[model samples]
Target: MGRQSIKFKRLTPFFNRQRLEQQFSFQLTATPKAIDKRFIYSGQVTERQIHKRYGVIVSESSETDDYVLDDSFLIWQGQQGLVIITGCSHSGIDAIIRHAKKITGNDKIQAIVGGLHLRCASLAALKERKSNRSPC
Candidate 1:
């Protein structure tokens, strides 16, 4: 057998419009499988000096639940209310949204996108979401 060279494709940075607002992404990837979900709505932190400045909260899921914090973030467009985004939400997306609203007091949801991850939950899975109001 001869040795082989491994070639990998180069990745590119995603394109995003430049904005002066706080943004972040949180991902939890290991846990036990018994604990139920939880929401941590820590309000809009627009302060530029210290580092706890962010505009959303997410459920800190436990290992026993067989669940993890997928990908969750807060979307804020200046004067608009907070619109939370989720990725493959094993943690309740509804819980995230409610926490964000309660924290920011911004009732109008601008939009919601990405995977629902319910596998076939239909109504019971995503009734708390803002629904198909996407301009996409």
Candidate 2:
């Protein structure tokens, strides 16, 4: 599947949450705009093997999409190589790695730390993944 575009209208509720919280006497800072493009990894990945069943509801109207385009991975460049920090990796680990490489223009991944989201994967799939591994 191709990358999907998210409309700004769908994000209005999230951006306006601070106003909603004010009614409850809770203080919250205004939501900041997204990071600049240069700091973000905007390319698509080759494989989206997992989290295919996941859906994202981006608006109050409950519109949903099968893919989570907002998912991200934190990459740190070090003297040794790149360290990737992720949360759940809803986009798939392989995809995250590929995107990280594309963004940094570096293929040397030093370490990967965080959730792989493989709990629901079948044993056969796990075995296949293990068998396909190559030394880094």
Candidate 3:
């Protein structure tokens, strides 16, 4: 058997900005809340510098040497407890959990689903994580 090379082309390259904007409507608020306050945004996150990454680009020339501050998680109040759903957790899992607890005033966490992004963590980093008790 022989290997074969394949090439792909993008069909849709441009978007209809005006039409899309007219079709969809959105509301932007400092405190994003939904579903009768059962679900809410974690807002700005303050993370520990243990696993921080730098050199993130905000614009063409501007960059940040700190972990992402805009990273957020979705907190859903379930029947049993609150479920924290995150995407990458770039801000830090501990910070997200703490924010969720603080905003909702609920310390009971039923489950945490989605990316923790700890695949490339070192042994010492994992040990440090273990030493710090989870807020959940």
Flag the better candidate by lDDT, 2 or 3. 3
Model 3 agreement with the true structure over 1-136: per-residue lDDT tens digits: 3333333454765545666678787554445466465787666655443355543445456545555656777888988889999998876777777777888888888888899877898989988876674545
Global lDDT of each model?
0.42, 0.64, 0.70
Sort all candidates by lDDT, best to worst: 3, 2, 1
- Candidate that scores best on lDDT: 3
**Reference-based lDDT, residue 63, model 1:** 18
Per-residue lDDT of 1-136 in model 1, one digit per residue for the tens? 3333334444643433233223644433232121222323233222211222122333345212222333344445334544455554434555555545655556676666556556676674355333533321
lDDT tens digits, residues 57-119, model 2? 566566666576556666777667777778878877777877777767878878888998678
Winner of 1 and 2 under TM-score: 2
All models, RMSD in angstroms: 15.2, 8.8, 7.9
- Residue ranges of candidate 1 with Cα displaced over 4 Å: 1-66, 69-71, 78-80, 123-136
Which segments of model 3 are wrong by more than 4 Å? 1-20, 46-54, 58-66, 122-135
Model 3: lDDT to the true structure:
0.70
Question: What's the count of clashing pairs in each model shown?
Answer: 10, 0, 0
Cα lDDT for residue 97, model 2? 78
TM-score of each: 0.37, 0.57, 0.66
